[model samples]
Target: DSMGDEHVWELLLPLPTTASTSMALSLLTFRLLLTSSSSSSSSEGYWSTDEFLPENRRRLRDRREKLERTLTESGIPYLPSDSGLFVWMDLREFLPPPPSPDESSSASSSAETESRESMERRERSLYLSLLNEHGLLFTPGLSMKNELPGFFRCVYSAASDGEFELGLERIGRCADAMRRSKEET
Candidate 1:
């Protein structure tokens, strides 16, 4: 009888074992939801270096410069990132276009057609090759404005003109290599 309406029953009857169990379960579920919500809300999603001590920041910056130099020597395009832990590479040109509705239907028919995993593999391979061949490495797939998983980020303390120049040189070399490869085939 008390179970018919929750609010009315609560007012009319003293708490029962079933009611207590239901209440406990609901509270537990609510608490879990709240905890997850708060955790996600607090995290801004991007890695920040402001929490580091000044000396540590300096070391990170120095290391970033050395890495940048190596990458430049090998020929990879990278821009000095202002967010302080990455160099941004524009990959808009390299990415394939969005499939049209007709194309999407055709793609769905072929299980081996382009896939997100395959795209990631290609990008990773290219990045690894650059690292191996030129000692230049980049954090691949990060956005300029937001942080996403598997995105490239650099850890550096300060930006310098010399670093910028070196980065450009490396990018030029990488671009040249890509062009040559395309021409050959």
Candidate 2:
């Protein structure tokens, strides 16, 4: 139900219909109960639900907020997240313009294909530049099957606060450098 998938709902509508599905569902239930029993027990120390769940939620929320603030300050357009660990940021400003059409060529399909390939390379280059130059790992939109060319997924769920801030700073510097280079060209 949480998946909002009708096909899944239909599949599970007749419970115990198939042995494999029934066994899989039962195993999932067993795992959930086992995890609940363990985490609910205070004797588990660090794994106790009371100790870590709220703290982890707070940390994730804080990290997302921080990323939102950095994106705002940098003038980087981003899709406002309602409930997710990742933010979709638009970096189209950093992508080079599409290839100019050849005056003698009437083959628009080839030009379009070339443009797409070129854009993909540019997008990969941006992803690599951030990773290699600043140690920031952002998922390229192309890999995510995003039709838009200049979008990237920025995850905010893992890094510590200090490390996250450092990454943000590095992003700022990279953006500034890209802007400078673009202006020069």
Scored by CA lDDT, what does every candidate get? 0.46, 0.66
Name the best candidate (by lDDT). Answer: 2
The TM-scores, one per candidate, come to 0.37, 0.69
Q: What are the per-residue Cα lDDT tens digits for candidate 2 across 13-91? A: 2222122224466457545643754545434342344544455466567777888888888888999986656789999
**TM-score: model 1 vs. ground truth:** 0.37
lDDT of 1 by residue, 1-185 (tens): 11223332222222111222244654464456335533553254321123223434464566567656655664544666433444555443333334444555344534445555444655666567566754555556632232322344443322343654465466667667765765676
Name the top TM-score candidate.
2
Q: What stretches of model 1 exceed 4 Å from their correct place? A: 1-81, 92-113, 142-168
lDDT of candidate 2 vs native? 0.66
Superposed model 2: Cα runs more than 4 Å off: 1-41, 44-47, 103-106, 110-115
